[model samples]
Target: MTAVFAAPAGPTASRRDTSPSAVPRAREFRHTTDRDEAIDVITEVYVPHNLVLPTCAVDMTLAWTPLRHLVLGYLSYGAESYLIAPKLETFYHVNLTIRGRTGSQRGAEEVETGNDVGLVFLPSEPATVHWSEDCMQLAMKIDKDGLEAELARLLNRQVTVPLRFDLALELKKPKVSSFVRALQHLRSELDEPDGIVASPLGVAQLEDTVITSLLLGQPSNYYDELHSSAGSALPRTIAPVVDLMESEPDNPRSLGAYASVAGLSVRALQDTFRRTLEVTPMEYLRGVQFDRVRADLLASDPETTTVTQVMHRWGFTHAGRFSTNYRKRFKELPSETLRCH
Candidate 1:
């Protein structure tokens, strides 16, 4: 019932670690026996409970990796704590419990997450989370613009409405299972010395992969439309347009121009595409362009051909967004593709 889209605000979570010297190379913070310090290091917006240690001193660990449009973090604290945020107005966070348990409430929905469960929080909603003393969580913060762009690409349309999601994720489902596995694998890579995730290519690929997985794996308002075959069964009379999309993907022609080439009224062409391919005419065009970009990346010499040059050639205006969509479709970074070839 609540909307998910939110305007950008100042940073919501604190990236600073409590013990600044423990892990200097990677963003890590460790602190003991200080609740205020913990809350300050966790996020600036939340109200923290259990200021006085219930039994033992506060033991906490926070480590994160910064990417172009996302942040991945591992967090753990040794005492029960309650965090309440009036509103999450900056980004979306997906929390995967690695150990112990977390109980979260948003609106009328409540969910408890453990090792196999995942929880989602949207920016426009208020949330209350209770973490057990032994809880360790992997937190993923996805940039608002980056995620909305991904949703737009997946739906092949302008996102005029907020993309709302179910509060709890069914991690047992096949798609969600695969997503968790990938997340674990990425986390492992990042923790390793000289891991691939340390490279620009790996970061780009993983950022997109995590966002796409969350979008597809979780139940959302647009889920049915994304998986439905309602429009893909259209008449086959529009094959000519498909051919043009494949043949001249970078023709720099507008949708209207493509309709003219197809010898159909603009509205008719749009309808034809929806009915036949289950995607808008422009969606197909963009797919073709993505395919061409992948092909060029595969054929390119990594040393001589940079990702920017190739992306610019294909009319990909924003590097962060382009990488997200590319990784969504290809499951690998453009640079990785080039490296393999």
Candidate 2:
């Protein structure tokens, strides 16, 4: 024989107040300060919580002046109100939950935000946030111009897209996951004392590559008419041709000669150029030469460097054309850049 215990009666049984019942109570840590030094210390401690959700606490500060990128992290007690004011910085933001279940209330909408959830916010936009106990989140601030330029390159058009996430949507797509991982890696490297000094060029390249990948994954609806229209697909062997061009910017091979080396006809090579890069073979070569010239100018020892010496080194047989195009691509003249530095 077994005795039966009655379920908790009326009020408790009928109630739908899950915040208290479903979530365990936890203490919230808040860091509010007007001091820059204190804020920096807090940011250093809190920014790493992006790796996992429901963190114990969150803190962050921006030491990089002009704030090219800003990251924020927050941990909150379950079922508490939080507010964030608008700032003058114009940047895109990505918010991610690393721990504990959480939700955000925006304007007239209240949505459940969790470990797998992420949201993007635009510059100068203000919003309030609330979270349940044990909730942790990472917020990244993206440079506005940098973001726009990246997206434009990917879609090949200008765009002004929205910043909210749909509940039904899976925000942690493969591309998104890769981006988050890359960001964490970059942040870690940047934090190292001698990291920047050791590999500044590599760091810059990685940053550019990550930004390009993210821009490619953005919503298609954000693309403009120019981007919507399909351009000719690049040739399968185009990579080899591009590699050859980069490796030998000073190669004296004619278009026909290069085409023969790549096992393609002159016309076929021209088509590949037009379709893939939207530039002719000769035009691309000129651009490559210019890049090499610029790099040498910036990095070479000035003691042995001269305008003509650098120009000839990059296969600029014609000073007039090189100077003309250099000015066009980089507004302030090559000499000016080299001289100023």
Candidate 3:
């Protein structure tokens, strides 16, 4: 029970020719206008596995006018011998397996991509693909910058780190099914009269929805040190403190209290902060509290909540100090963030 899915003909290409000179070169594959020619060039450069590729169907559509966008592709391959170009380009890719087992090797690590996992690949680096005997994959490609910007907004911080292509997170069955349904629906809309106008919007919404679900579904412990690794020396110690200050801004804990909880002497913590994050612990805490206050003010109903009320709620007791810090952190006055309605 092996299957090999073929790429559709329209404006696409498959790998074709190879020569001795093209073997395992350490250079990126240049972008190509001719899809088929590019595929041929790629197939020639890489070594193919000798196995019977399973049975699968693949349908792909490219939106090249506004931006480079790939609609969706479904692939199921049995035990088949095929060569995947070592270097593959993508703006961004989301892949989920529906059945069987598939594995990808990046650098020195090998990761299994299966029905229980969803993987995101960013445009930072090129990677090679390999699969097991029986595997089914559904993938979507999208604009890298657009996806990054939207993720930053949702997370309320910059999120431009490269995705570890080999990393795998458990995917809930509901999300896998929902993504498939959305892809099918998007494909159907692509063939309609107003398909052009509606398809892009639908795709954008679907991308956002799926991303949101994935983020919310991630284990909290998984992201506990997200900010700690950004050149922060005391990432282990400072990360939790920052999270705590942001989550409980009104707690009114002093620097010493935080240091005690972090199991560091005040001076040791201060040195780590300076060495790692290039800021004092108090300064970082102030920034965190200000962010919370600003967010709270922006989310509050102005008709029901006052600016001072929001400020005091987050431990900004000194109006003058609070205003100064708010302006410094957000470049806007506290009054400006609140909703007039």
Give lDDT tens digits, candidate 3, residues 105-214: 54455576656565655454444455544444555556444444444445443342433333454544454455445544544554353645356666567556545444
lDDT of 1 by residue, 1-341 (tens): 11111111222123323454433234544454576787677663222233434554567667667666677776666677666766565477788776667899987899887766678888768887788876667777776657877776676443545678889877788877767767766666766758887588987787788778877788988777767765223344466667677677767678888788778889999887776556788877787788678778877888899988889888788999999998776556777777874
Give me the runs in candidate 1 sitting further than 4 Å from their true place: 1-26, 44-57, 229-262, 266-341
Model 3 TM-score is 0.40
State every prediction's TM-score relative to the real structure. 0.62, 0.47, 0.40
Ranking by lDDT: 1, 2, 3
- State each model's CA lDDT, in order: 0.69, 0.51, 0.50
> Which candidate should be chosen as best, given lDDT against the real structure?
1
C-alpha RMSD values across all candidates? 11.0, 12.7, 14.8
Please report the candidate that would top TM-score against the real structure: 1
Tell me the deviation in Å of residue 103 in model 2.
21
Separately for all candidates shown, the number of backbone clashes (residues 3 or more apart, or on different chains) is: 3, 11, 20
Per-residue accuracy of model 2 over 137-248 as CA lDDT, tens digit each: 5545565545655554553322334322232223566655666566566555554647561575765665665565455444434423223445322355665676687689
Error of 2 at 119 (Å): 11
